[model samples]
Target: MSTVHIKPVPVTPEEVIAVARDHARVVIDAEAREAMAASRAIVDAIEREGRPVYGVSTGFGALANTFVEPERRAELQHALIRSHAAGVGDPMPEEVVRAMMLLRVRSLAMGRSGVRPEIAEGLAALLNADITPWVPRHGSLGASGDLAPLAHCAMVLLGEGWVREADGSRVDAGPVLERAGLRPITLSSKEGLALINGTDGMLGMLILAVADLRHLLTMADVCAALSNEAMLGSDRPFQPELHEIRPQPGQAKSAANIHKLLQDSEVMDSHRNDLAHAVQDAYSMRCAPQVAGAARDVLAYAETVADQELRSVVDNPVVLPDGRVESTGNFHGAPLGYAADFLGIAATDVGSISERRVDRLLDITRNRGLPAFLSPDPGVNSGLMIAQYTAAGIVAENRRLSAPASVDSVPTSGMQEDHVSMGWAAACKLRTIIDNLGTLLAVEMLAATQGLQLRLPLIPSPAARAATAAVGPIAGKPGPDQFLAPVIEQVKRLIESPALRHEIEEAAGPLA
Candidate 1:
């Protein structure tokens, strides 16, 4: 058999998402090796000189000043894992655990965490073999870099606890590795510290969120196009020149996207002539470009933070090139935490406005002569009425979740761990909010498409028409109570697909 040597691979945030969603293997490269060596040298010097490093040579957390004997350092490391693996509640879903593994591997590949090369190799190997440690969902303050959750991850390397195998079986980490023909790495000086001391958990969730956010933003544009067509609203709000005068990047881009999606429609110019109905539509329909545009702006800022974080080494006691080891708060999750909280609020608003559009479509008075709830049978069918309620419920929940987690702080590790960022909470809530938004938008897509069809035989804007066609088969407007969960999942698949998004955009005409 030919040998295929696996080398260390460079990772980007997008690659992390891909690996999380689709079980992809990971490898390390030559460049990563060099960086690892540099970090190891600094850590080794500190160890040999008997200098007290926060996590490497002393007790962790509030007990940082408590020193340990040299011989017991390994035991100390193991103890840290056992004690910090205090996560409670339901275990995280497989995809999230996979995301954590991918993020941790990429962080080590950056080669600044002072972990042994073999440690990184073993972690990557587990991922390659699809051995994901079963970590709990709830128990991180998001300060000091997701310490509790990551400790569970590190414990699996010690062959001490249970993990999920490729086939989704929960088994002991030791036997799982044995069956997979992979050996666990030994805990050494700063190795355990390196593994558990970072913002990988929060960052992993953020990577997934940002990717989904991009999709939702695109879906927002598509939904707006459909609403515009259904309402037969004037397209003047999307004029490029109108946004140019205001000069907001997101506004300009969003308006351009709307203009492009509606460009080829014969119905648009026909409706532009002083409408007998009123001057312009409500803010939800006419100001779709502006409101959705703001979300794009916050998402851009969140992306920058995530990209830089992927390349960063966010552990305590960083090692420098000149063989100097310094204890610092690099593992602090404030930056990512605050950004995630902001993104939660912004994305929550997206769903909030989407529900409003759903309300308009369902209301008999405001729906421009469409049947109540878009039902052909009206009171007999109650078509899409409860779906609007579901949408409203999710949006209300999002509002509650939108309250910033970053603003709250609780002291842990005694007073030493004072001023926590609650970053993990922010990331977790953001993930929930985004998922809810996806379902809400999916429902909106179904509702708006039905409204468009009722006004049928009247051609819609090219972009809206194409999106409707793409989602038609996935989430068709069925009669009452047709098991919407499956249909919601189908629409989610469409939302996640970049190819479908591009196709819809292409049909809309060139992006303005």
Candidate 2:
């Protein structure tokens, strides 16, 4: 409930995520405003000298050498924003737009963008009011720091573009600013360019994706263990001694979680000495910890990149401590793009492995004694057969989504930016991959929980019972086919919630 203060230093990814997703209010710290004032003083001194500056006294991109009269500089900045407000496709989710605005303000607050402190203050106020700008989905090339999308955000600050109202309607921003007792920002010489020239958009998406994957990865372990138990397979692969030698931290953590979840299972004890069970389980069941743990490590690396980016000053011609304004390539988004793409591939693989588990749960030949498609009645009901189909289709889509978006780029701005990062594309596609992964995992959870249900009097491990109990309200018991989409959605929401983790941890202790 506390306001997220904008400090003079770099912000944390947690703070950015809070502001974006939680609607946490923000206010600029006085020290950051003072820093901006000092930085602005340096820019003011330069403007009076009449020497050409890349963004202050001259035009942008390929027109860097073109000069405008002192009287036309304000017009130049506004014109720049208008021309760059060229994004196409649907509006980005409100959370992404909010995060982008917050990051821009954070960069300006760092005293590097030569922006007036008021610019940051006005943005903070808009964010506090939840007045989200309409940033179209496609625009950023990732090299120029998501210019077009950020430009749309900057246009909203100037009351020139549309903003999403409290009722979720897109309306003119001028009246919204006024009704909220806020005034439109009047761009000074460099303020407009200052607002748009940063890697906020792609970085914002990367941060959100990391947050989502952390939870989903943990859930991946939960579902994997449930499948192993439901299929009547051995949990020996999750034994700590088996994984300690390899010592991949994520793998160890996942193995420990599975080891804990499989404890107290009467089913495993039911067939322990019976040679009827397969000597070894399929890779999906036995190698669950390996693949999911690798994904956990991938997310850790991506989180490191996200944290570094959060603290970086990602703008061109940054105002330095020594009163120099020098053009730099710090705005390039290659780092964020690479992180997004890597996480995408990892998430896709995690989903693929989970889909295989779902297939095993449904296949009569493979499910040991469970019914075909996990149906309560074989021929009378189709059961979750279609759910496995959904998982397979989603897994296929995720594989395509995992292709590296950062590996490709197109020149823009008349070749002034000859090599683009395409990181925004990478981050955006990563969002989709994570979402798809979430849904596919939901199917695994659904089918696996139903498989646990069919086990009946054969008691499940404490962790499996707890995890299934968390979704029991909607998932119910194994029965004739019901509408599966709503149940998948319900379980998806539950998987993303704290309740599942709380219950599972209560029984299995904290998951890694």
Candidate 3:
């Protein structure tokens, strides 16, 4: 699909990923153009009127008291970038760097940061040419605008650093700019502060994380249904009318997805006979909707925060339309930081519940008709027993990692940057949790599929049947203790593929 054109309204996290992955071009809107013009006019007035603004005539951060002469202003901006480009860690993935460039362009397009037009243009050219800067993973408090990492970005604009070219070659920005016929930007007034001070880096990571999580959530519903069918658990918990009374959008949506994924199967309808072994199944099966639904709720709120961050001109000393410069704390990462941590907590639960289901599948007493290790030769061969151990270990790790990152802070920048959001920590940690959830889900699929195969002749719940149809041909049933790793790997790919992901999303839509 072609990328949607955005005006002044904030861009959603999903929109940011779609644009970057699909190579969308961003254009400045009329209002944004006027905002840019007003900012530029104020800057021109500063240069002409000889007004002493914080960053325009003075130094940055702890060096605010030192003043730069008018002749040295351009040199000062260049020096600011060179000195602050001290980010040290592994280089960020290429896609993330591209998303950062896209986000930086969108933020500048809002036109309130007093940056020159070429600054935004340079970013756009990089996006078009697929030039990704080698931004590092660490060294940001997620306040003061993700200083170290963003400085690396700004350094590329001056063509004084290095960037990854279209074909993955790292080239010096100076010669590349000369070859591309582009000029190095000279910072004017608040431009350096504008370029470096904002939540773009954290926001970019969150956007990609959220987009991938949305897909993973869809995969979770399908996997949960498969596990549900393998156990022949009652489907009474997912009645649409029951959820309709309270009507949280996410809860209602999850219940509906469960219903649709099981709609055509004979297995769900066949078990209407109330043979009371226990009145109902456990909470892991019964409360899947509630747990999964709550995550969706947090995701909705996080999307709002992500969108606002994308469009906001978050630099300090913002140029107001009335031609006044106001230094403020809009660059703080608290909102995005907390949201990322909340998302990690929410996503972590999906893995937690799925682990319980994996345990249930392996327990012969709990699993009813399935074999002790889910093996045909129960006593001799230990089949899928160890799979649960792997899932358990992953779930425990996720629990430890889900601790809130926003609650912690340390002083920096001579204590001026005291109470940072730690949003980068939140973003990176959440990315790990999401990946772990994927592997956990993959493990469950291997075990559940094995259990269903053992419970042959007796049909599975309707949702399980559909999931088997979706994944069975791709990964056939294992035999005689063969390497189950390939089966788990295959199921993970099926769960993650665009086709199966779309099917689950369609199932989720009716509840909305």
Model 3, range 1-512, lDDT digits (tens) per residue?
A: 45545444566666677666777665555665565666777888887788778788889877877888998887788888888889887777777777777777677767677777667767777666556677878878888868888888888888888777666666778877777777777776667777788788888888888877787776677666767767777777889898999789888877777766656545555566848545688888878888888888888888888876776778887887788877889888998999999999999999999899888887889876677767778667778777778888989999999999889998886877778899988988998998888888888777776666666766765546555666677556645676666777777777666776555445433323
Instruction: Give the alpha-carbon lDDT of every model.
Output: 0.79, 0.90, 0.76
The worst-scoring run of ten residues by lDDT in candidate 2 lies at 164-173
Q: Give the least accurate 10-residue stretch of model 3, judged by summed lDDT.
A: 503-512
Off by over 4 Å in 3: 1-9, 12-14, 28-34, 165-171, 175-181, 269-271, 274-276, 503-512
Residues 1-512, candidate 2, lDDT per residue (tens digit)? 45788888888878888999899889898899999999999889999998778899999999998988999999999999999999988889999999999999898998988988989998898898888998889889998699999999888889889897656677888998888898888899988889889999999999888999999999999999999999998988889999989989999999999888898999778888887778889999999999999999999999899888888898888889898899999999999999999999999999999999999999999999999999878798999989888999999998998889898988877889999899999999999999998899899998888899899899999988887787778988888779989999999998888788888898878888
For model 2, the superposed segments whose C-alpha errors exceed 4 Å read none
Q: What's the CA error at residue 178 for candidate 2, in Å? A: 1.0
Ranking 2 against 3 by lDDT, winner: 2
Of candidate 1, the 10-residue stretch with the lowest lDDT total is 1-10
State the displacement of the C-alpha of residue 436, model 1, in Å, after optimal TM-score superposition.
0.8
With candidate 2 superimposed using the best TM-score fit, by how many Å does residue 6's alpha carbon deviate from the native? Answer: 1.2
Candidate 2: clashing pairs of residues: none
Q: Score candidate 2 by lDDT.
A: 0.90
